[model samples]
Target: MSSFKPSMSEPKSPGSYCGVPAQRSSQWGPEMVLVKLEDCSHPLELNVIVKEEEEERGIKEEEEEERAFTEEQRAVTEEAEQRAFTEEQRAVTEEAKERAFTEEQRTFKEEAEERAFTEEQRAFTEEQRAFTEEQRAVTEEQRAFKEEAEERAFTAEQRAFTEEQRAFTEEAEERAFTEEQRAFTEEQRAFTEEAEERAFTEEAEERAFTEEQRAVTEEAEERAFTAEQRAFTEEQRAVTEEAEERAFTAEQRAFTEEQRAFTEEAEERAFSEEQRAFTEEQIAFTEEQRAFTEEAEERAFTAEQRAFIEEAEERAFTEEQRAFTEEQRAVTEEAEERAFTEEQRAFTEEAEERAFTEEQRAFTEEQRAFTEEAEERAFTEEQRAFTEEQRAFTEEQRAFTEEAEERAFTEEQRAVTEEAEERAFTAEQRAFTEEQRAFTEEAEERAFTEEQRAFTEEQRAFTEEAEERAFTAEQRAFTEEQRAFTAEL
Candidate 1:
């Protein structure tokens, strides 16, 4: 029998085998077998006959025995592999358990250390509290001691001030007494000198009065002499008047003779013998008038001598009488002067005694006034000193109080500053905590973004590989179709 092989490039219809067209026939069963035949005279006759059932049954029995052997070998290999995987899994689980136990031990050690640190901080705080209490006690004791010392000092100063004030008052009183004594002595000396001057003036006035009385006596005597001289002068004036009348009568006679002579001479010029007679008559008249004047002068001189003798006699009489009167008046005046002298002596004695008594009284009054004024001055000085001391004490107390207030203010300010510093520290710690939280959140966001980007890149690479494989499969299908079409052509 001969076999035929189909060509790779043979064109076949759909659902056909080896270039043969398939048909449905009753003579060919569903299990039809393909046969190869040589060329023959009759188109349907076969040269070889074969039993299909017996050959197919032998081939099926051999294939079943080989498949059973292969299944047994595969089962042995699977069992071995499963045993190795179970052993490796047990080792990995044991390593993981050891690492978990180590982490738990380390956490417990950290917790123990934190507890120890907390206990040490609590002990330190307690020690600080005890120390603060001790310091406060010491400060309170110092304040009490200082106050007691200040009180002692103030008392000592007050005692010393009192003693000083007493000394000053005693000194002032002594000085005032000395001044009053000096003033009294000066007043007494001035009064004594004034009394002496007044006594001298009185003596001088008495001497002047005596001299005036003597002058009055002399004036009375001179007036009596003057009256007698006036009577003698009146008698001399009467004698002189009688002499003048006689001389006037003689001069009238001489003038009549001279007139007759002059008339005869005028007639004689007419007659020569009458002219010689007229010359003789003129000479005779002149001689007669000269004799009459001489006689009158002699009678007047005799009358003047007679009047002087009588007047002198009267004056002598008057002088004797005036002297006698003057002598009598002098005796009377002497008696009056003695009596006046006695009265003046009595008046001077009385005035001197009254003046002395008045001066003494005035001195006593002045001394009393001085004593009163001194006492008042002393009292005023004492009041002023007391007021000054009180003011000084008040000022010292005010200064001390101000100092204490300043110290208290300084302490309060220190406490306030410490509190502010603590607040600043707490704020700094809060800011640090917020910054740490922000950093942690930003790191987690960055990790998430990086993971998403990696996943997207892996997905893109897988999609590109799938598309390339599909394109290669389509190209292979196209090449096979082209070969078949060429063979058919």
Candidate 2:
């Protein structure tokens, strides 16, 4: 018989395992390369068949021996000793025959029991053999399965090791490529670092410039605010000063008015007292003249002539006193009217008041004519009256004192007094006009200065605002430039 053998170095091929005819007709797939047997027959049936064959052979041998023995015995003893033996056996009897038959039966029963026991032992042995063969086959199958599992595990391990080696080779190639580019990368990194440093420096400078611009703008704004505040304070001070000045001017005007009123009242009282004293002197003079006239009439028998002279002189003196009073009253009224007009002109914007001017001029002319007429009449009447009285009553009026003549108001003295008063009033009015003009000019100047200051402040504010806006725009543009530069880098 040919046996299948497998090699350890190489793998097996696809094939079949089968037994020869009359030996074992076993079949198996390609994987079962080892030799194997088929299942055995039932041992009980084989035991029954063996027992029958053994019994047949024993019977046949027993029959052949009995036949041979019967032939021989007949040839040798059938003619000689049969009668005497037969007579003796016959005399031996039936009890000995019975003992011999019992012995044979016991022997056959023992032999049959022994044969059954042997057959049972053989069946038990055959069953034990079959069980052992089945056990061996199972053990072999388990071993094969274990070996196949081991082969698969080894194959997986080899694949894993091969992948690890390939990965190591690829890493080595990558390291070589990286080494080749190291110089260029190092130079590029250095250049980038330098560029970053320069950009940082430029950005810092731009930031500082922006900060400086901001600081300057803030300083300018602060200065502008301070200047504006100062201007405001100055304006307030000027307004306050102007108010105080106006109050002072009003007080001065009130005081001047009060002084003028007092002066006018005193002058009027003095003038009235002077006129009364003059009238009393004239009366006394008249009484003296009448006494003188009566004496002449009594001494020389002069009758109606002396009486007529005394009455005529008295009438003339009375008329002269009345005219003087009238003239004084007219002068006082004219002066008062002129003073009122001048005051009104000072306090009003009446430069074009032509009617008032014309009226005042006409009134001044009328008063002047009246004053001249009164003065002429009074001078003429005084001269005439004085000449007649001195001539007619020279002897009697020789007692009149020279002091009275000196006390009398002549036309030249009155004219000189009026001229002095007029001059004083004109001078005072001129001073007031000059003062008013100065005050008005100063107020106008202050207003103009305030307007100019306001314009200057507005211009300065506009300039500062524009400067700040320009600086902010420049800062934004510079920042954009820096950002663009950084992006390029």
Candidate 3:
């Protein structure tokens, strides 16, 4: 033998070296070959020979493997480049799909954003249109309210002014009526005065005529009484003279009888018996004559006493007539004095009535003056009130117009808030109108109540006065009746 040559060491494949050794290893490929080793633990390494067939086979197999790997890689480059090349392929494909999905998501998000933006724009436009419509409606309502208020104010002012004018005219007419009443009363007073004066004059004339007639009758009675006294005195004087003449004749007859008796006695002796008897008869005749003379003287003295007593009675009667005449004169004078006194009393009463009338007239004049002044003041006050009311009405109208203009301006300036502003204005106007209406009603009620109270008081006073007048008239009638009955008694 050839000298023992050293064998070339072969690669060993890994096996269980302690238990058993590997016999052989199958050929895997050029990348991995199977081999068994003698002292190697098992098959530690795989060895391959580079023969044509084997190489061809290996190459083919390698090519086939490569081809398969390339296909897998394509399915995974399509799948992952078959693992490495397949893994590279798979990574590339996954990256491309991710990029495509991201692009789709981005496109979808953009479309959605566009749709939302369009919807928001439409809603905003609708809200703006609604706000504009509400503002217009409020403005129209405010305008209508202001116009109606102005019309109401105009009507109230017109009515109040007409009432004031009518009241003023009525007061003026009342003043004229009072003046006419005063004139009529004055005329009545003058007529009464004239009638009283005429009555007084007639009474005075009648008294004067009665006095003249009484004086004439008194003179006649006085003359008759004087005539009766004179006649009685004359009759007494005639009886005295006749008795003196008869006494003188009786004295002469006695003297003649004495002389005849003395002559018979001296011549009677130696004459004769027949002569003696004749002398004695003559003596008896003388004695008888003496007795007759005594009787005649006694009768004449009794006649004188009777005639004196008769004359005295006639004088006493004349004195009584004189006293009667004096008493009559006194009564007539007393009656004249009483009549004069009555006239004076009547004149005094008339004066008092005149004074009362004058005082009443003065009071009436003063009242009239005061009433006139009050009326003038009232007229002035009413005029002022009317003017003030007119001015107020004008001011109210102007304010209303201004308010209308302001509302228009506000509507234009704040068209968006016009509805709210108009509501506030309307509420304020309603409150003011209610207050004014209440005030007017209160004033009317107060005025009517005052007028009613005054009318009631006047009626009461008139009734009282009428009752007093009736009572006084009844008393006067009773007194007059009593006086007439007494006079008759």
Q: Report the lDDT tens digits of candidate 2 across residue range 427-464.
A: 45445544655655765675577567657755865786
Global local distance difference test of model 1: 0.45
**lDDT of candidates 1 onward, in order:** 0.45, 0.47, 0.47
For every model shown, what is its TM-score relative to the native structure? 0.22, 0.22, 0.19
lDDT of 1 by residue, 210-272 (tens): 344235324322432342243234334323433443355546645744663574356335434
**How many pairs of residues in model 3 come into backbone collision?**
26
Off by over 4 Å in 1: 1-400, 403-407, 410-414, 462-489
Candidate 2: regions farther than 4 A off: 1-253, 279-420, 423-489
Over the stretch 136-184, how does candidate 3's per-residue lDDT look in tens digits? 3543454354335434533443343234234333575456535644764
Ranking by lDDT, best first? 2, 3, 1
Clashes of each: 0, 0, 26
Question: Global lDDT for candidate 2?
Answer: 0.47
What TM-score, to 2 decimals, does candidate 3 have?
Answer: 0.19
Lowest lDDT block of 10, candidate 2? 42-51
Candidate 3: segments with Cα more than 4 A from true spot: 1-83, 165-489
